[model samples]
Target: MKISTETRMGRNRRNPREERSSFLILCEGPTEKGYFTGMRSRRGPQLDVDIPKGDHISAVREAVSRVSAEYDAVWCVLDTELDKMLTASMLRAAQGSSVELGLSTPSFEFWLILHHAKYTKPFQSADDAKKMLKKISPFWSEGNTRFSDFADKVDSAYARAQQISPDGKNPMLNPSTSVWRLVASIQGRPEAIGRSTGAGRS
Candidate 1:
């Protein structure tokens, strides 16, 4: 996408040029923000990242508050296994206070890929999953794998990640039920991660 990063400078009120915001990225923390920065810009001529730095919850809210006409799309990269307090906090932080929770069933697969690549720290930041990207065909394309190819491998990989007795739970490695459901939905299938809330204990 074509992003322009010339935010108005120092109270210059009447300058038409200063009315634009040239920055493009808005991330939960400096790490993910850094993830974008560390990557080779394949967009070459068309891509420029201006992601802002904010706590995951607040950053998402702030970006949504901005006009969509201003940027390509606002991505709120957040965690799935949130505790009640953190959940409430993020929901409260959401723009207009609308709470929507969802995730992909095999979210860890994504994290694993990032971890293997070290683009993110395997259990904590997006950097971790960068590791797994190497197993895919698009080795040099910066997560260039087509969605079509990666669809079937999650269950097998998740089983492996699930078995890992890491000293502690890898935050980035944990998969959310919502993410699993999202993947199912994308395949034109039903949600398959967990029992329905309606499926209470007998």
Candidate 2:
């Protein structure tokens, strides 16, 4: 049997600039926003991240309202400490829409903690998670958290999250997080890492 040229070259290859996946990330707060912004800065041209003003429940609402074909994906990065009923309603609204929610138990700080340590202890609140993070990562402070702090440790964090929650389907699991799902999605793309070309998630 003769092999076809398309098969040998791989039929999936395309122009990164033209087919680049664009994402609209609506974060719950400054910390979440800053981390994703840093991700945008580090991702290759194959990915584009657009973060607009909106947070927490507002972010979920914005994501629901802004569901359009303009962007490939709409993500809402939020914490679970907000009003349970309100968050549930917004989450219901997101159903059947393009909006994908990345929820961290208590707060996004829990996800950060995974970067420094493998912790499965449940947090009482965002403040509690922040306190724990401070103990291990003194660099993280209110309004001062940067992506560079955890840039090199992204893989470690992802692995830790997986260990905590392998399925990664629940947003309400205490001491569990879904942020790794979003990060893994981005890292899976070809040439997704901005710092290096052709970097693949390991």
Candidate 3:
């Protein structure tokens, strides 16, 4: 059998601009890690996950320390949970660094909830967000939900999240999330950043 050059190279040929970028995602929760892990497996991005101890601020500090370690980018998946003071501190910590944040108000579950429905109601606590998410996705459980659970709805969730807030500038904003930015990066659609519009089908 004869083999063509296209078959040999397959779909591995990426332009200079399309070259795969490496990422270091820092988060504390298992659920966030699980979802990003699933994305890494499927999306083919050069990514690494780091679970740091302590609060979201610590995660930002960790990202700051690691951002210069040769990775193309570094991000923190954090739940601000209506704590403006803490959120402000975190933002301050990341200001001079290349550390990006996938911030969700009340909890990361709210970001997941966007996958199923459009909601903008503020939750007082992480538990409140989790309870609401359970009502929407009855099967959702912390640390166990994988990307495949709602893989097909990524574009929808991205659109819904974009509708809620335009960017990561306001982590203190209630019921808001910038997780869509991280999702866009993982999808190799970094141009989607700050785009408050259309849904890009992944």
Using Cα atoms with residue i matched to residue i, what is each candidate's TM-score against the true structure? 0.36, 0.77, 0.83
Ordered list by TM-score, greatest first: 3, 2, 1
- When summed lDDT is taken over every stretch of 10 residues in candidate 3, the lowest stretch is 193-202
**Candidate 2 lDDT over residue span 1-202, tens digit each:** 9989989778767755465567777776668767777776433423334455655556566777876776666677777773466556656757666577777787889999999888987777778888999999877885877888899999999889888877556666787787787787666634224422110110
lDDT of 1 at 86: 52
Clashes of 3: 1
Clashes (N, CA, C under 3 Å) per candidate: 42, 1, 1
- Stretches > 4 Å off in candidate 1: 1-23, 38-54, 95-173, 177-202
- Minimum summed lDDT over a 10-residue window in model 2 is located at 193-202
Return the TM-score for candidate 2, rounded to 2 decimals: 0.77
- Poorly placed runs, candidate 3 (over 4 Å): 1-19, 193-202
Question: Model 2 scores what on Cα lDDT?
Answer: 0.70
Model 3 C-alpha lDDT per residue in residues 1-202, reported as the tens digit of each score: 9989898787766664356667898986898898888887533777788799988788888888887756777888888878878778877888766677778887889889999999987787989999998999888888797999989999889999888786556677788888888888778676755543211110
Please report, in order, the local distance difference test score of every candidate based on alpha carbons: 0.36, 0.70, 0.79
Candidate 1: how many backbone clashes? 42
lDDT accuracy of residue 98 in candidate 3? 68
Q: After superposition, how far is residue 10 of candidate 1 from its true place, in Å?
A: 36
